[model samples]
Target: MDNSNGMAKELAGFLIKHYTEQLHSIILSPDPRLHYPLLVDFAELLDDNPTLAHLLFSHPAEYLLVFDEAAIWAQKVIFKDLKQWDNASVKDYVHVRINVSGSPLECPETFPSIGRVRVKHRGILLTLKGTVIRSGAIKMIEGEKIYECRNCKHRFKVYPEVETRNVIPKPTICPSQSSKFCESTRFNLIEDNKICHDYQEIKIQENAQVLGVGAIPRSIPVILKDDLVDTVKAGDDVIVTGVLTAKWSPDVKDVRCDLDPVLVANYVRRMNEVKSGIDIPDDVIMKFKQFWLDFKNAPLKGRNAILRGICPQVFGLFTVKLAVALTLIGGVQHVDASGTKVRGESHLLLVGDPGTGKSQFLKFAAKLSNRSVITTGLGSTSAGLTVTAVKDGGEWMLEAGALVLADGGLCCIDEFDSMRGHDRATIHEAMEQQTISVAKAGLVTTLSTRTSVFGATNPKGQYDPDESLSVNTTLSGPLLSRFDIVLVLLDKKNPEWDAVVSSHILAEGEKENDNCNEDLKSTWPFPMLRRYIHFVKRNFRPVLSKEAENVISRYFQLQRRSATQNAARTTVRMLESLIRLAQAHARLMFRNEVTRLDAITAILCIESSMTTSAIVDSVGNALHSNFAENPDEEYAKQEMLILQKLCIIDEFPDLKSNLQ
Candidate 1:
């Protein structure tokens, strides 16, 4: 014990001398951006005292207490040695921190899966990688408190202890006299000498790629203090270095019973911004390159194969599948000099009859995307879909919704027409501007919602052969116009088509049974396709060629000229959609330039949507009618016609009796 005390004092003196010599260089350095709490390498400290270094690596919490005491001792030494030269400024602002690096003694454990972490690992220093799901507000916590006794006018300091029943400890007796303290002898908190530190809490969930299908994601709470607070936001992937600690209930008699584990983070590193390629095997890469070469050599057959690989179980709807494929592989997002952003994501809407495989396709898309969320219109409200501010511990805390949570990925919404009007209106801004503005309950902020929306809905009325699509759907014109592609699937009465569909369904069922007996095989599995999409989005940025530009421009001009009155034929949004689709098509071919063929494919997709929605007739003529304009006109006309026939029958009494 005597040797330990002497070693601590010697280490304190050494640190003071080291800081004093480095102070001038730190302040005079050319680099203006220097991190506060200056980092001290552990290797240098180990050279001075090997025993202290060993203690620090083996038991960090105890070492942290010793280091903090040494820091205070060093401060006093500096103040006394430099009394004549701005001593107050150095005492107030200069902070030194120790970061253990290049030390073989302290080898951090491998990051554990969130679901696999156990209570036995508490108090151990470990590293973990996850995605931030929620973040709490930054707050100030009392590190040390000072109290002055009224009886003796003496001051004492106490370090705030965590997981203790008594938060504020009382001094045993008056310092001047060893007597029992009475009620009149009170202690008042001294504000000027108190030490406070910034603190925050965040919840991180396990990464999606590591979990199997249907597995529930698990999360852990991490407590960040001092310089580490507010370093990351929700949806960011981060690597956290921290010591796991347990929190006990204040009312519990036994401190060790039912302790809830939490982590106290020392450092956080954002991982998403760093470019780490997906872990694809070398053989897989070679096969992927050969597949692309085939696509480049034969464009038509390659495109068909790609579409088939997207969702093999669902038969037919080839155009709809192509649209979904393009949506998965998004285009390049661009921002102008003025900071205005143009979204590259393409939105799709599918409206069809029952048993049309709408929900199945949506599920398949959600599974293939790297980051995605699925919700039903009836199950989610406006606040639940966007952003909600809830009161937590007497302060407003912002919680991200599905759109905000899937910012850089996909959002799949089913039964879209069943949602309330108010609820549906909330997504209008998010759909176009790619942002959600919240001004509820004194908290006002705008959050990014850069997500591609893929929705499916059923028609309102029964399937009618002669009626237009606008009459059967419940969506408004403004909402319909936001989708880049809208495909309407009708059940046609064709025996030949029915026979083919039946045969395909039966073949799929047999194949599934056969796969149970043999090893399962898929041409393009979900994992490989997901990695391919991520690679394309990360590495490829396609530019439009002159020929492609001419083709798109001519198509837009032709559509605008042919539009009739009150017809929802084309707008500037259509031109932007065409460009996005063409770029996505170029990415599908693994090319850096949008070719004329890509432009033609984009035009064909747009034309197909327009035809299915009845925006234009068979011969390329505009249909000047919609659900939003004079919605009740058809009902009123039918009622008037029935009343006129009733009047005619009333005038002819003999005819009325004959009918009866």
Candidate 2:
């Protein structure tokens, strides 16, 4: 004990001297909670005296409590010692707080996994990483209290010990020895200025990928005090360093019940806006290079193979698959010199028949993306898709929804037309502005929603070749215009196509029976493709060549001039869409310059989409460049001719009356 006390005094003197020099200017700053680092090497301290190091690391609060007077004396001595050297002046009595953050190598007690935390781990320091799912309100905690005796009129202070119990300790009897203390209610309590800490509680759940499919993710509650409070929010991935402690039930009868484990955090590190932390190996890079080389040699075959690899089970929707692939690869997002952001991510919509594998494609896309959320329109709401203000611990807390949570990634909404009109309208700003603004419960803030939207829906009416495509789908023009590529899938009664599809399905079934797994596997594995996409998105930025630019401009002008009211006219957005698609095509081949071929391909895709969805005349001829402005003009002309014939018949009836 004597040796430990001597060493503690020596450490206190060193810290006081260091603080006196380091904080001479900032000692009188407004923020009194400013703490100085001791900067002592724990390894050196251990080598010199193991007991002192053990006490300092293991029982820091106890060591500070034991040598409080010695530390104060050291502080005063340093104050006088600094005055003689540098003429520094400050308050004669000021409490000096110290902090120590030792090297990770020296902290062997730091446990990595929260799953391995057990009863034996209590009171020990640990490190854990998880996603914050919930948080409570911040409150003030009293660290010390003063009580006055009612009968004897005597006052005394009590420093509360660190314990899990919620109840405050009271004096057993008055200092004057007047009478035995009956209850804590009989004494008048006093607040101590130096004994308070700001506190908040948050719940963190394990990463979803770490737990396999169908396994329930576990969560643990954590407590943050003082500077650590309000450091993290929901949907943030964080690494926390803290001490494990047990929180017992308030009721004494429930003593045998299981105690809740809570971590008192000392440090927190947030990991946000980082998508796909997968480290691509050198072999994977080599494979990607080889694949690119082959793709450059045969662009059409390579693109088709990549599209097939995206979702192999969906049969005979080549165009839809190609659009989805382009959306996944995306274009280069740019922020100009004037701070106007042009979005790179493309939006896609699929309106098809019931059994056409629309939902299947959506699920596959959601699973393939690194940070994605898949939700059905019927099960979602405006607040659920954007943000919500919930009351937690009697305080308003802003909770992020699917779009906000999927920031910088993909969001797949199935059954798109099933959503309420108001609920669906909430996504308009998110789609265009790439942001969601909330002004509820006196909290107004805008959150980033930089995510690509991929939606799927079923046709509202029966599929008839004679009917207009807009009449068959419930989506409005405004909503339809948001999607860069809108693909229409029909279950046409083609005998040859049906037979081929059936044979493919049967082949897949037979492969399953024969245990032939090669057919079911993707050419590029999902993880490898995800890593490659992330790498390209981070490293490559494609620029449009002059030839490609001219082609796109000419196509946009021609399409605008040729468009009639019935046919959807090309707009500025369509021009942007064409550029985005061309860039995406260039990126697919790992090329930095968009070629004329890429622009031609984009125009082809646009023409195919328009031809499939536009109105056709009764003679089964699609109104391409000569599309009529009014679809009802021919009917109106026929009605007028019939009226004139009836007038002529009425005139003939007068002449026929004489013959009868």
Candidate 3:
């Protein structure tokens, strides 16, 4: 006991010598009664006293108490007058939050993943990263309650045990004396003497992108105390530093008494950034620049190289791959003068036959984004796609659905045609407005759904050249318009194409990739490709050049003159889609200026998406298109004819902006 006291005194001296400034500020705060934990960097401690730091990680419960005592004593020593801030003398000080820097001692290689946390990690400090799937209602829990015995009128304090959380156990006999002498089991608890603190339970699930194929995502319960409670909610990505502890499961008849692991959070930080909290290094950014510099002259060909990495096994769907890249690396989001928000994310829809590889693209797109949610639309409801109110522990809590959870990322829906009409209608607001408004169970709030939708659906029966998309898919015009690029992938009978697909499939690994022979040399692997995507999204935000704007205006006028069957083609939404695609294309080429070539490419994308006869005659099937030898020359000739037509419309300035 004397040795332990000396050790604690040594730790106290260390604290006073190291964190004197931090302790002084916290102690001299306006309200000393409030708990303001002094953040102690563990790395600094490791440098100062390696032995003490190692002991702190091993026996956290005992050492944390000592650290708390040291912090209080250090504050009093530094300030000299601790009672000036508080009316009475302080008995207990706030906790010392140890910031675990660098890699933890979980695996000795890297920080432990959520699924890697096991029995060996219990009672020790570790860090975890996960998404908050659900959170319980905040409630006051008793930390310490005072009890008075009836026999001798003796006072004692009872703390809630881990197994029986929030429920203090009653004493069978008087704690003041032995049961044989007292012969009393009665005890009275004083409500006024109870010490309560805010508490909540949050369920965190591992990242889906990190999980293996067909493996079920694992989740763990986290306990938040005091100031940590209610700091985060569903759909948030959080990093928690805590101690792993175990609690007994519910006691039921014929049920085994098992212990479940739960984390008691020491510190919780929320990362609400759009990048999914990925930290990219400066050297990697230099690599990206060097990757582009290799193909300085032919930028379009260079972009195709990156697109080749998208679903590499699938053959000859250059257009689909290009659209996927543009959708993932979307345009800049800005607010207009009227305070209306313009979304930058691009939505894509693939309407194809059974063998057209639509589902392949959907899966690949989901895997491409760091933060994504993939779900089938079969039997899906508005509550499932948006937000739903769930009752947990007799309290109402708002649970995030597919779109809500995929905020600032992608939400891919397979079998989109299988969803009900009412269910499909619920996502119209989420797709365009980028938010889900919930007013249920006496909770009224809005959750962000700033995600791009990648949906794949089949057309009813056979392809109809004369019918509109709404009649073919049974989707409303408003809903259909939400998608910026609606590519129709009809598996038309062509013997040459069939022979090519047959030879490719049979050859397997020996299949020839004719579309990207030279460009595929610079194709990146999956990890590097994903990092490149995140890099562009985090760094680049492109703005339109005047030439790009003019090209977009010309295409909008041409579409309005064509009198499209699709309602999406006729609205101002189409114009917004054009600008977004152009900006995205510019970013894909690693340029800040949305070039004229970018505008021309976006126009060609829109032209191919439509089913008009004029487009089919001029632009070939998108699935069969390849990287042109000289795209600039081809685009120049095409824009010349469009410019000739624009000259006629130039006569009437009033007719502009009235594309409807």
lDDT of each: 0.68, 0.65, 0.78
| TM-score, per-candidate, Cα-based | 0.72, 0.69, 0.86
Candidate 1: regions farther than 4 A off: 1-60, 64-119, 126-130, 146-157, 162-193, 205-220, 246-261, 274-277, 280-287, 336-338, 463-471, 509-522, 562-569, 611-660
| Poorest 10 consecutive residues by lDDT, candidate 3 | 651-660
Which of the predicted structures, 1 or 3, would earn the higher lDDT when compared with the native?
3
lDDT of 1 by residue, 1-660 (tens): 355456557767767666665544333343433233545556777887787776765666666555655655665665555555541323233334555445443442435777777866565545677888778888877777777888767776776544452155665554443365433457777888756677787888887666888998788878887767888877677777666776654344454455556777766777755623566677876876788786664565555656656666775566777788888887788986989898999898888787777898898888777678888999889876898877643667677777887787889999988889998889988988899998977877788898999999988867553544455676766677778877776565457767866776777657557742242353366677767766667668999998688767876776676644213437788888899999998887777999866876787677666643212332121111111123134323432332233233354355346456
Worst 10 residues of 2 by lDDT: 618-627
- Please write out the lDDT profile of model 2 over residues 1-660, one tens digit for every residue: 465567658766655644455445433334445322222344555655576657655655455444444444555555554655444444322332322234442243454556656777666545677777666778887756788878666776666443544345776766553356434335777654456767788878776556667876677888876667787876677777666777664444535655678776656767674445557788987887888687665566665556656667655466666677778778888886999898888888877777777888888888777777788898789887888888743578676777877777789999998899899888988987798888989877788888899998887877564544456666666666667887667676667767866777877767565433664553566676677776666667899998678767766776676665324325677888888888888887677899766776666556545633222221221111121234234333432332233233233344345335
* lDDT tens digits by residue: candidate 3, 338-425: 9989999999988888888998888888888977888888846788789888875457887788898899889999889889888887
- The positional error of residue 541 in candidate 2, measured at the CA in angstroms, is 1.0
Native-structure RMSD, model 2 = 13.6
Top candidate (TM-score): 3
Predicted structure 2, TM vs. truth: 0.69
RMSD of each: 13.8, 13.6, 5.1
Candidate 3, residue 523: lDDT: 60
TM-score of 1: 0.72
Candidate 1, lDDT over the whole model? 0.68
Best by lDDT: 3
